[model samples]
Each structure stands twice: as structure tokens, then as C-alpha cells.
Target: MKKYLVQFKPFLIFIGTFFATYILLTLIYKSYLNHFESDDVDEITRIVGYNVDLLLHAFNSDVFIQKSVSNPWLEVWYNNDYVIRIVEGCNAVSVIILFISFVIAFSRKFKTTFLFILSGTLFIYILNIVRIALLAILLFRYPEKVHLFHGVLFPLMIYGVVFALWVFWVNKFSKYAK
Candidate 1:
């Protein structure tokens, strides 16, 4: 048992650190969210919706997002048609949290880790907004394939990027690399 434990020490440490960071950040985010009324969207989600609206407009699409009166989501309207709801999950904070957790688990130098986390988080956030905007436009054009685009393709894209970032970190910057 001791031999096995010694052999797996690094892996165990990586797993422990990853979960600790993920849980801590998720709890903090949930607590922040708890401050909002049930009928009101959290600030992060609202900002995501707003950014999606801005991106859509940049593409010359008739787009606007408004808080839904009946639910804690933003209604995204494209070309005067109700297209999709920008819910909290659509905000991608959870994905960012996961990304940060993995990066921290394999962390190296403080400056490098900090810069990577900051840049990675920003990149994920921007990509999420672009994903939402593109999704809204695509949904408007191909309402028939909502499941494929939203459920599979977009998720694959975001998670794929995060996975790539994790791989890059491990090979290029992590302590494990040394």
C-alpha cells in the first residue's frame, strides 16, 4: 500500500489540487449568484448576453437581448424574431472555472500561472460570446438543427479549446513538464 501510494503521489496531488480549486471557485461563484433575486439574472450572465448582443450587431444582424420578465434569463431577439434564451449556463463561467482549476493543478511559476489563467479566462469568455452570437445567428437560419448546433457542436468547440489549453499547459508550462 505504501509503495503504491508513493508511486501515485503526484497523480493524487494533481487530483486533489484540481478538485479543491474547482470546488472553491464554484462555491464562491454560487455565493455571488445567490445574492441575486431568483427572477433576476446574475451579473455575469447579463454581461454575456450584452456582449452577445454587441457581437451580433457588429455582424450587422438585427439583434438585442433583454431580461425575461418571466424567468431569470435574457431573451435574444434576432431580426425581430425570438431566437434563444441566454441563461446562466450560457455564460461559460463554469468552463472558465474548470479551466482555471486544471491550470492551477499543474501550475509552475507564479507569474506564468497567473498570466495563463488571466489570458485563458479572457479567451474563453470572448470565445463564449462569439459562440453565443454565432449560435443565435445559426439558430435563426437553421431552426431545424438546434440540437446539433447547440447541444453538440458549440459545446465541443468550447471544451475542445479548453482541452487544448490544458494539453499545452501540461507540456509547455507545467511543473510536470520539467
Candidate 2:
């Protein structure tokens, strides 16, 4: 009924905007993955990740970057010492998704959502820095385990954290959920 619709307009708007953004973005993301080579962004991520990796290794660990190749062609990096370093694309996506999901889960109003998104974004950036650092150490210490370390484990870990945060937000923080 019109009355019910009017009462839920704000809620509807939030849901609509959130879902619309997500769905549209997902489609675009898929299209890009299918049609375009995103090696540029991937290379940028690798550069960032590698820098973080070196910094973490400097904290009294045996990790060393003997040589790194910035392959602009396929976004691949090879440590002359250790072959086939993990790509940074997936890590970057995970970081971005984590913050977006956090904002959706935690925020109620526009202002709060913006602030919370910013805060969550900051956390995402920091977590990425940490992720890169950890990845570097693991890459050095367990070079053969790169697939499990980069492809499976860290992403699962980050997503698990985001899922927990989402559960907390909906149960403990979201006013609309109540």
C-alpha cells in the first residue's frame, strides 16, 4: 500500500542504492575480467605489495628481495631468487570489498555511512599493507607454498574477518536491522 511504501521509503532507498551499486559493479567487474587486461592496476598493486613486503622483511627476518621484475605485460612478478610471486590483484579486490561490505553493514545514515566507509577504507588500506607484508614473508620463507599462501589462505582469512564484522554490525550495530 502507499502508506506502507511511504513508511519504508528511506529503508527502500538504502537497499536500492546498495544493491544497485553492488550489482552494477559486479557486472562491470566481470566484463573487465573477461575482456580487458587489467595488468596495469595489477602491476601497481604488485609494486605496492612488494614495497610492503620488503619493509616487513626488514623487521629482523631473513626475507630478501634479490631481484624483482615489474612485468607490465601480465602483472607477473618474479623474484630472481623465488619464481612466480603471487599477483596483487586479488588482494586489492579483497581489501576493497571488505570496506564496502563494512560500510553497508555498519552505517545507517549518509553522514555515518561516509565516515564509517572512510574509516573502513583506511582499515582496508592498512590491512592490505599487512597482507602484503605477510605475503612477502611467506613467499620468502615458503616459496613453494605460494599457491596456498597467496591464492587460497589469505583471501579466506580476510573474507572471514569481513564476514565476522558484518555479523557484528547487523546484530549489534545496525539500527535498521533492529
Candidate 3:
């Protein structure tokens, strides 16, 4: 029993740390969301939707126009014909939290881990905004392939980025790296 415990200690620690960090951050986010007015939607999600709407509007003023985002929900209309609704899961905070948890599990030096988490989180956030904007544009252009694009491709793209970041960190900065 003692030998088995010793052999699995590292794996156990990693799992523990990952869950602890993930849970703590999730709770904090929930607390933050509690301050928002909407019962169905959170403020961070609304901000993400707002930013996506703003970016799409800026890119093509005449084509991709924002219909309404004053409330918690975001609705962006394309060519005054089709509308794309930005929802909570599209916000990408969950992905960031997952990324952070993994990074923490394989942490390096304190300063390095902190900075990497910050930069990585920012990168993911920006990517998510662009992703939402591009997805809206794609849906506008190819309305027929909505499920293929939204349900399959976009999720793969976002998760792929997260995986790439984790790979890079493990190889370049993690203490356990060979």
C-alpha cells in the first residue's frame, strides 16, 4: 500500500491541484455572476457578446450590423436579413478555466506560471472573440451548414488552441518536462 501510494503521489497531486483550482475559479466566477441583473445570463457572457457584436460591426459597417445588445442578450444582424445570437457557452470562460487548471497541475516556477496563465488567458479570450465574430460571419455566409460549422468546426478550433497551448507549456516551461 505504501509503495503504491508513493508511486502514484505525483499523479495524485496533479489531479488534486487541477480540481482545486478549477473549482475555486468556477466558484469565484459564479459569485461574480451573482451581481448581474439577468437571471438567465451572466455579465461576462454579455460582455463577450457585446465585444463580438462591436467587432463584427467595425469590420463591415453595411453588412454585419449589430441589431441590439443593450440587454443581456446579443443579436447581430447580417445584411439586415439574418441574425446571429451569442449565448453563454460562446463566452469561452470555461475553456480558459480548463486551460488554467491544467497549467496549474503542471506548474513551473511561480512567476513563470503566473505570467503564462495571464498571457494564455488573454490569448484565449481574444481568440474566442474573433471566433464568435467569424462564426457569425460564416453562419451569415453559409446558413445551410450551420451544424457543421457551429457544432463541430468552431469547437474543435477553440479546443485545439487550448491543446496547443498546453503542449507548448509542457514542452517548454513545465517542471516535469523531459
Better of 1 and 3 by TM-score: 1
lDDT (10s digit) by residue, model 3, range 137-170: 7887899988998889989999999999999999
Candidates arranged by lDDT, highest first: 1, 3, 2
Instruction: Supply the global lDDT for candidate 1.
Output: 0.95
For residues 1-178, write the lDDT of model 1, one tens digit per residue: 9999999999999999999999999999999999999899999998999889888888788987999988999999999889999998999999999999999999989999999999999999999999999899899999999999999999999999999999999999999886
Root-mean-square deviation of candidate 3 = 2.4
RMSDs, each prediction? Answer: 0.7, 5.2, 2.4
Error of 2 at 98 (Å): 5.8
**Which regions in candidate 2 have their CA more than 4 angstroms from the true location?**
1-15, 23-47, 50-54, 57-70, 73-80, 83-91
- CA lDDT for candidate 2: 0.59
lDDT (tens digit, per residue) of candidate 2 on 17-127:
667666665676656555535443344455555666566556855444322344432222334344334454534654565457545644677776666566656666667
lDDT (0-100) at residue 11 of candidate 1? 97
- Give the TM-score of each candidate: 0.98, 0.62, 0.89
- Higher-scoring candidate on lDDT, 2 or 3: 3
Count of residue pairs whose backbone atoms collide, per candidate: 0, 0, 0
Error of 2 at 53 (Å): 4.7
